[model samples]
Target: MDAYSGYNQIFMHPEDQAHTSFITDRGLYCYKVMPFGLKNAGATYQRLVNHLFAPLIGNTMEVYVDDMLVKSRTADQHIPNLSAMFTILKQYKMRLNPTKCAFGVASGKFLGFMISQRGIEANPEKIQAILDMTIPKTVKDIQSLTGRVAALTRFISKATDRCAPFFKALKGTKRNITWTAECETAFSELKEYMGRAPLLSTPEHGDILVVYLSVSASAVSSVLIRSKDNAEHPVHYVSKALQDAEVRYPDIEKLAFSLVVSARRLRPYFQAHTIHVLTNQPLRQVLQKPETSGRLVKWAIELGEFDIHYKPRPVMRGQAVADFLSEFTESQASAATQHITEPNPPLSQDQTPTKNTLDLTQPLWTLFVDGSSNAQGCGAGLVLVSPDKVALEYALRFNFQASNNEAEYEALLAGLRLAKEMDARQIQIFRDSQLVVHQVNQDFTAKDASMTAYLQHTRHLLATFHAHTIKQVPRSENSHADALARLASALEQGMGRHIHIEFLAQPSTQAPLICTIDHSPTWMDPILQFLQNQTLPANPAEARRVRHRSARYLIINGSLYKRGFSLPYLRCLTPEEGHYVLREIHEGICDPASKRLAPRQPRLLPCRRKTHFRGARHLLKLSAAKPNLQDTCRHHNGLHKVPHWNFVQSSHFHFPINKEQYLGKTKNHSPTFTVTLPELLLVTDLGIGERSAGTTPVSEA
Candidate 1:
């Protein structure tokens, strides 16, 4: 019975080893001592014990290695249960450790948790370890100690904000490490609170409600428990210090994090009961629908795992005491259970406008649009702007067969094209289709070839305007467009035609086309005009082909492509134009190569001499002196007389070779000198004649 070493086998007594034939016998007569450190020791022990007492103990008694707990409700049944377990131990020759046994106790501690007949509580020894800690001298020391105690703080109340001031004082350049009155108070209060922590009732037998609250830098959470008898109690409180990055999140995001963390921390309790989350913020508004922002949407998705309803502040305070009770309350424990559950009110129409309104004062014009398709035809809708905000436009382009996304894309394209026609210098387009907006913005890649082509065309259309921007607005904010899209779909379905058109004019003398719908040859002009003005392809054949294809889409499925414009509609050009367009596309796709080829090359040339120099006065003097000496020697030794040596004069004159000699070199050889065979034969033949005894006649040739 060591705690770390589990029980699976019994050691033979030294006196009994001689009588045991476990070593020699290989049959059933021998009882082998099981190995203690085997991988299956724990499992084997549990299996063996369970099998041995299956008839007597059944499910009443459970043993895990050396630790055992026997659960029974009444004392009358304990003696028999104890006796049955003792008989098994004796039969197996297993000895029990006297000091490690506990019997007939109403509550017992095991597996790092305390369990009782009525409830569960934190181990006092674990809490005492936190209380005995000395004051920290450094930030690291304080954080380490606090982190260890924070694990047990879930059993205390107001753990986050209550301890914030103490944690804050640990920062700064002051090294004196003085504990302020607030820090000392918080520290001592935490220990005292844990010492008197209440036992939490089992969630299986109670109705649980969790209240989660969050600030910019911290999140606080608490759980309330109430039995069917209406006796309510505070089970435990938990909190966590948010990272610096988390503290900078928007108010909605912070509130979302608070609820998400609380739900996860209390999953065991909340999972067993229908839990209600009461918060000071309007979390219901966020949870009522999906979010477009990935971070918020992901957090919202995490919140969906628990069966909990979000109660807003205004509604929560009246129906539930979340705020006051969350802090410090001495009211009767039953007060929390007195409030009646109120059903959520039906949504009012007046709230719809407030929910969808955008901030129009911002520099960019925000345009919202949506599209839908049904059995009748595909329809697209767009709402450019309203007095206070941008209204979602609902345009129904009938006689088009496409998917929901295709319709959405057509609607978006129409809105963008209309914005461009309005001379909107700066545009901020909003839509609930995250896929469409993200794809167009190049934030995500197009997974399909058709989508890739359509996205490319859509981006080209967007680039025609100055300062064009696209963003994903929440579905709630894009309601106007959603409504228009639904209406268009309804119109198409009711009409049962290939083409349908409608226009909502602005409230002015001009009555400009705020919206348009058409399905006829006559409507083609306006559609063509819209495309042309938007710099969309304008070839009639191409347009007719596009219109026909788009019409076919409507006829087949009553669905238009997402962002509405078809690939052919955006690309109305002949084969030649298409070739050029393809070339341009290729160039754009290969821009990296073009960038590398743009720099100029450095200049290089062969080296050459600029000028040639003539003979100097010093060279002329040396030539004159050498000739004078040669003439004096010739006059004395009777050699040839020296001619006039005009060395200085000759140096100033330029010489030219004779024309015959200069041009003497013909195609093969120069005529300056010729060698005869007789001259060479004389030298070679003289040696041969001198060595011969007989005289030989030399032949002349």
Candidate 2:
């Protein structure tokens, strides 16, 4: 049942009526009833229906803005349900459009979709509109085509991949589009698919749902499926086009990303039912223990709210599901070098190989690696040759110093990473470094700590593949990789050259030291929990307060940031971290003066001064404690005065601050150390790191 003039049903308040005043031909007029096209008109009507049908919505009826759906399990309950709905409408003085309303119907259109007992389906008009569209020749036509596809994305599996050619055509020139033959082929397939679009299934209560994930070069897709009577039906289809850095994510990370995207888009389904992610990749382990990358940590936190489980996808059951799963499985298999699928017989005299089990007869990829380290610089290079004889060459320059053996390990590790990204199952490695190859092959022991770390890391990556072999080859035979390594290592500090060189900031063996505030309860704990998982305190008042405060805050990549009036967003920090930042700013700003005063000590103590915190970026002016009256400090005991020093956040250094009182309180009379206010008082709940260059920490002294 559809409400007649839904917005007009609600009368505007006497005071609000004046705000809707408009000039007419005769005189000014104001609307007594709520008017359409108002920014909050739709939302206002939705709230009214929600309040009116609070007991029936989601149980016996469903409503969105003006559209109302009255549902019953059988014909016997239909009249009673309609009676209950009509009683509420009578009490609220709401009228229904007789022409638009349909009663006692098995299936009908609701919210631009065909809804019935069978399942929700795309409207026939929408499918006809796509079928009626002609071949797009201009940019606008292609845009219209993409816009139509966007409306039916939930019904289309891997929608982004299918429409990638159309998106590519829209790029570059706006007036004229580059309509390639790929577009024509994709357009025809799309119409063919639309003609027989699968009917989506509505999951019943307590029914477990399954999600099949697919990752392509530029997009990630997943289909949510519901199984009943040994047959699978698609609940929804989701696909996202990767942008910028997302396009370069490792294949495993991309698989995890597909789940995250599904969880976000299908949040309602995830919240209501249990989700089992069907995949062969180690997505569960990667997300469960996300210490390797920051993005993984964030994705894991966001997905923690839902009950998601990982399982190896079983054999396809239904044709609708087979259509989606077949494509997903085929894409992954075809990406591997010489990958083939063969069914194994049941166990008897000869047992058949299980799924995903490696066949030794398959061709293995070849990897050639070399490293160069000299007075100029250190660098590594590798060439990965596929079974099909396609070769991929990569050069990596180390930002930090590395020994020749370490560089060789880096080269081997880089090659393994490339192979993994290409979905290679078996690999054979040949390296010019005899020590590295022998150590990896277990012929020699890695006695050095750094070498042991590198060896362990290499073994960890090697474990991902089905099988791998490492051997030492003469430098003469590995000339390609050796020359690439030299080319990258010998390049000048500042030169214009582009060969897709990658800079390794640090070795993979070393884990970065990051200060995480999520472990303990802080000012951001309540807000972070609410924003991430919708978790709130048991107390009603506390929950309300958290909800109100969360409006000004949002979590981005696992960090809490507060929206500010002056600034767009500011990262929140703990008081302990704030004190560390202030001290670092003092050291960086007054490094030269502190070294001049106490050349032997080089300690720039934080003096008494007012501090201000605001905006995403801030400049801090710190006063360095100087005993002498000169512009620069020369002594540590006579008389002290504040000096002007300014600095921005650039680097981080570790130093300890004396917490003793600084105002006229002296124990040993060694220039009374002032502790001033507490750590929390120095910076509010919102704070950031500050630093400057060239400073010797007092801890070192």
Query: At residue 99, what lDDT does model 2 achieve?
Result: 96
User: Compared with the true structure, what per-residue lDDT tens digits does model 1 show for residues 1-701?
Assistant: 12223352555456644454444456544324545555766677777666776775435675555677677779998887788777877787766666766788888876556888767688788887777877667776677767766766756655776677667777665565557888878777777766777666655544555554534335534545443364555565656667878756555555567666766777766555656665544555543322224565455445544445555433332211243334213332233223211222323332211122333443456688877778755667777873347543437564546778777777877787777655464566778888897787667888986576567556656655445567788889978778777767677234554333563222111225577655333323433442223222367455444433322121111212111232231223333333343233223343223222212100000111132111112222323645533332233232223333212223443212444533443313423224332232221222111353443233434
Per-residue lDDT tens digits for candidate 2, residues 633-661, read 22222333432222222245211133343
Give the poorly placed runs of model 1, Cα more than 4 Å off: 1-4, 7-66, 80-96, 112-114, 126-148, 169-178, 205-216, 299-305, 311-383, 386-701
TM-score of 2: 0.52
Specify the poorest-scoring 10-residue window by lDDT in model 2: 679-688
Which candidate tops TM-score?
2
What are the per-model C-alpha RMSD values against the true structure? 30.7, 15.8
lDDT of 2: 0.75
TM-score of 1: 0.42
Every model's TM-score: 0.42, 0.52
